[model samples]
Target: MVLQSNVRPGLTQGLIALMAAACGFAVANVYLNQTLLVDIAGTFGAAEAEAGIVTTLTQVGYALGNLLIVPLGDIFERRRLILALLGVVSLSLVSAALSGSLTWLIVSNFCLGLTTVIPQIIVPLAAGMADERNRGKVLGTVAIGLVCGILGARLVSGLVDSLWGWRSMYWISFGCMLLLALLIRLRFPVSKGTASLPYRRLLLSLGPLFMKEDVLRRSCLSQGMIFGSFSVFFTTIGFLLQAPPYSYSSAVVGLVGLVGIGGAIATPIIGRVIDRKGASFANKMCMLAALISFLIAVTAGHWLPALILAAFLLTVGTQANQVACQANIFSLSASARSRLNGLYMVCTFLGGALGSYLGVWAWTRWHWTGVCICGMVMIAAGMSAALGTKNGGNSHKR
Candidate 1:
């Protein structure tokens, strides 16, 4: 595993934990708005459907960042790029907290998403630093933080909103980003980028890179669809829980995220399975889990326990599938990992943006039933794409 001359030593368990923490803190910013959509809409006297745009725009900004900013990881010093983005995201969170109108909040949230792509940057950095023999295990450990941040964002935001107000959550997140930046500055080692390509060519390379890599294409499609379903579930679940048959408080909705810990606990084990059984097998298993989750959710409209069970399964599926897909793509190119990651994330978040929009659309019409059906359709499509691929036998070779 050759690396750039200035690349730091291989990951320590402590460094891996810090990378995981950074990924968690940075990625949490993108999701803080999910559970707060209802409170935000009420505060601004906007319709639920109108407020849904906040989630969609955040995802759109993330997708754009993956396209425009993440590829820079290949050209610039990664720690510097990461810390700079953290500073911008901190300011964005403050802007969100101080937003005077829904429009203002929406714009600020988009900025937050645009700058909150530190997790994506960190993943490639970690992957590059890890030993090939245990790369899956390292990635899975880091993914635990990613998973926790994503699910924990809902839990934290919901409680903060319930106790203080929706805006308070942003204030807390702002402080978190500031603290995260300082820790990263102290703890992370400097690693120069491998690629020295001109900026324009760096961006242009994404097209050819995507076109040339079969594993990259399949991984993108499978993960995009699964993440789309993930977006659909989280985006609308709060609204459903707050309505009839449940009439739950925001705090209760947040607690549902805690229930997802069952899934988080399984990620390391999935990583080991990927190491032993291969990413293709893990991908298929994850898709099946996701499909069954939606199937159960379709009948969970009136049952809290069933809903909880479904959420757990969905979390496991989405998080495991992410590990599998990322492991698959990162194995393809040592030098182009960042660019490949950028293309892959761009598609994944585009799917998320679409899911956020579609989830709201379905909720406004057919409610929870509609959201479940949308999720099922996405998982089914992802399964079809994964099954169509012929890479299953060779996926473990790397």
Candidate 2:
């Protein structure tokens, strides 16, 4: 029988609330650029495809920050790092709000993404706090908030843009970051460990985990490919909806993301399945579900309800696989948890960053058919990666 870690810890309710708040606000930064891309393009006198870079550059910043900033949680006071990150994100949001040029807006957006590492920090922190038996459930709750923040950002940004303009979205984000920073500073516990390690070595050590560990490699690669597929759908859907007989407004296109609400709701259910049945089973199901969504997306053009259902299925796959990856990693070791999460997320975000650019480029050059094919191909790649790992045995191998 496996020895479960502490099933219950004496952590406070206040800390849990603060963690959820931090995740909610932090994830909003990743997607704030999505709903506003068209408006930003118009404001900057830029092409739509070029404006798509706003999302890509922000994700690029996130990928880099994951590599550089998240490992510091193991060596620094997690609370201090979290607060500082929120401060940087707030300032970046303000800069984005005040930008007079497209170049400046994109730069500020990149900074915002870099500093949004607050959620990443909080996830490891939450895992370190919860007991093994309750780990998936606790983390699932926070993950729910993270997914909600991501989904909600697009919805609110679009709705706000409809009412007050796109600039208002940044201003509102600035306020949310500011308030969450204060709450976190006052409520969350400070975590200080491994402070003696040199920062450079701390970052360098994560490389070996990939080289020696198959489970870690597969986890990172699976997430990377899954997110790549997700980015392909979202990045181009705006153009698709605005063009055809649908010809939806930015608000309508953004509202389409509400489909992810089902994924958020399914997190606890997926967590339970992983806790009882194991991650391998859960991972396989997620990969197959995502592949089906790709097929649905490819063949169901101009059918609003079918396309919406496909979007929901795609998000469900992404979130389930994400939960499996987290559970697999956190179950491995307590000491290296932060570094492990940092390494895994950097790869995943890099996948997302590539997908954003690739999706936009495909749409521009080859149209929606090309973009759909790209999404299908990425999902198939993810399924193949999952198949390669099925008989590898144990979540710790990768």
RMSD of each: 3.0, 3.3
- TM-score of decoy 1: 0.96
Question: How do the residues 1-398 of candidate 2 rate in per-residue lDDT, one tens digit apiece?
Answer: 22224444445555665677679778888986787888888888999888998999899899889899998988899888888888788899999999999899989989988879888888888888886666677677777877788778888888888788899999998888878877877777767865467898887788886687677788888888899888888888888887878887888877998777688877777777767666667777888888888788888856888889888998889987888778777776688888888888898899899899989999999887788888888878777767776534543232
How many clashes would you count in candidate 2? 5
Give the per-residue lDDT of model 1 (tens digit) for 309-366.
9999999999989988888899888898889999999999999999999999999999
Clashing pairs for model 1 are: none
Candidate 1, residue 126: CA error in Å? Answer: 0.8
Q: List the residue pairs that clash in candidate 2.
A: 214-397, 214-398, 215-397, 215-398, 216-398
Give all TM-scores, in the order shown. 0.96, 0.94
Worst 10 residues of 1 by lDDT: 1-10
Error of 1 at 360 (Å): 0.6
Clashes of each: 0, 5
Regions more than 4 Å wrong, model 1: 1-9, 391-398
